[model samples]
Target: DKMKNKLNKQPYNTVLRREYNNLRNRITTLTRAARDDYYSEEFEINKNKPYKLWKLLNEAACRSNKKQNKEFPIEKWIDEKGKKMCTKDIANKLNNFFVNVGSELANKTQSRNPRAPTTRQRDSMFLCPITEKEVMEICKTLKINTASGIDNISASTIKNN
Candidate 1:
């Protein structure tokens, strides 16, 4: 408070500013150390209770109260033929399936099922086209200073223009 008051009284004083910054740095360091110590103590006390351990960890991490997904990523998996597969192998399998799925679907569609109905069924169709004006209005309402995604069009440009 004294350093802060001194700095406030002489805003342009470099010595006061330096002292204030040093005082603030010391306070921040001490506070952080104390917090770490408290968290460490809590973790030690709750080591036996997994729920409380996770709760302490979440608190230390500043996580929300929402129940988080507890699913752990598969590091290694057992495949058919009793073979142990690495993450890369599992990833390749998934990738290959996804890559071929479209072609497989197309092939199946080309060779239509014999049990299919021959009638060309008709149904009511509705189409609504969003105008450029509406699109621009929405773009204008976007939050500014955000990252430009894959297309590299800036949020500032979208919001302003």
Candidate 2:
């Protein structure tokens, strides 16, 4: 009976030990994977900054009428072999080019006019006479304009007479 009891306890101990080891291994793998993912994401974000700057430079160059080779230093980064490099390499080169070109362009270019109209300009254009007359009639009926009263005469009404 003692021998049987010892044999039973041995199997239980072995199984419990294996379960603990398996759990530890899984946790280690998961933590490493998480750390790797975080680092990779950080690297990608860092890489994209130069890429975005390069794209902005390219867009600005495209908008201008000047030839790329003559107007921008980015053309110099292109290898003589004519094969395009990766975005990261191109971006790094272009960022440097922009630093050189941007200052010159800023000094030479005039500031753009504000797109939207000023408050005075917006208020200058009034409603059309035909629509204005309809509005005036409604106001007269409501007795909202007590000062000069409302003009009931409309262009079409006078024309028909």
Candidate 3:
């Protein structure tokens, strides 16, 4: 197939990687710029650029991952209640099941081995505050290109900053 051939071809793959990187760089620049100049008309244009680039990147990834076979549909799923569920219902049922199981496991573990009582002697002198150097070291040790945190800051950004 054309897709398979493209993946195999070194020149094509090089070009593809370059384009993907360029898009990512442009998107990141636009995003930071838009945040600073939120009220500007250019912000409107900047906002949409990332989404468009993301869409193309996602499509390319999907295409790269695809095989010759067509995607198959899930017929149905049976929940713990022995009731047949559709595709939409399956996710919620599985989530609830896993959550309940996790709680049960936690309770069982806690009952089996309880925590020891804390000693009266405190060692506050031994516990020193973390330094800026240590903080930077910790950030540098983190694996890059991972998903952003709840604050929407990436590990690379934190490490670099």
Please report how far candidate 1 places residue 35 from its true position, in Å.
0.6
**Lowest-lDDT window of 10 residues in candidate 1?**
112-121
Q: Which pairs in model 1 have colliding backbones?
A: none
User: lDDT of all the models against the reference?
Assistant: 0.86, 0.63, 0.70
Clashes (candidate 3): 0
lDDT of 2 by residue, 1-161 (tens): 44445546776687665766677688889998997686566556666688655555555455653556555344346555886566678888778898889788889998687578556665576765578778666545543323332686554444333
Best by TM-score: 1
TM-score of every model versus the real structure:
0.39, 0.23, 0.24
| Error at 149, model 2, angstroms | 99
Estimate candidate 1's alpha-carbon lDDT, on a 0 to 1 scale. Answer: 0.86
Query: Which candidate leads the pack in lDDT?
Result: 1
* Tens digits of lDDT, candidate 3, 94-150: 788898997888777755577798777575556679999998889889888799989
Q: Which stretches of candidate 2 lie over 4 Å from their true place?
A: 1-12, 48-161
List runs of model 3 lying over 4 Å from the truth: 1-76, 79-84, 110-113, 119-161
Residue 92 lDDT in candidate 2: 81
Error of 3 at 86 (Å): 0.9
Global local distance difference test of model 3: 0.70
Better of 1 and 3 by lDDT: 1
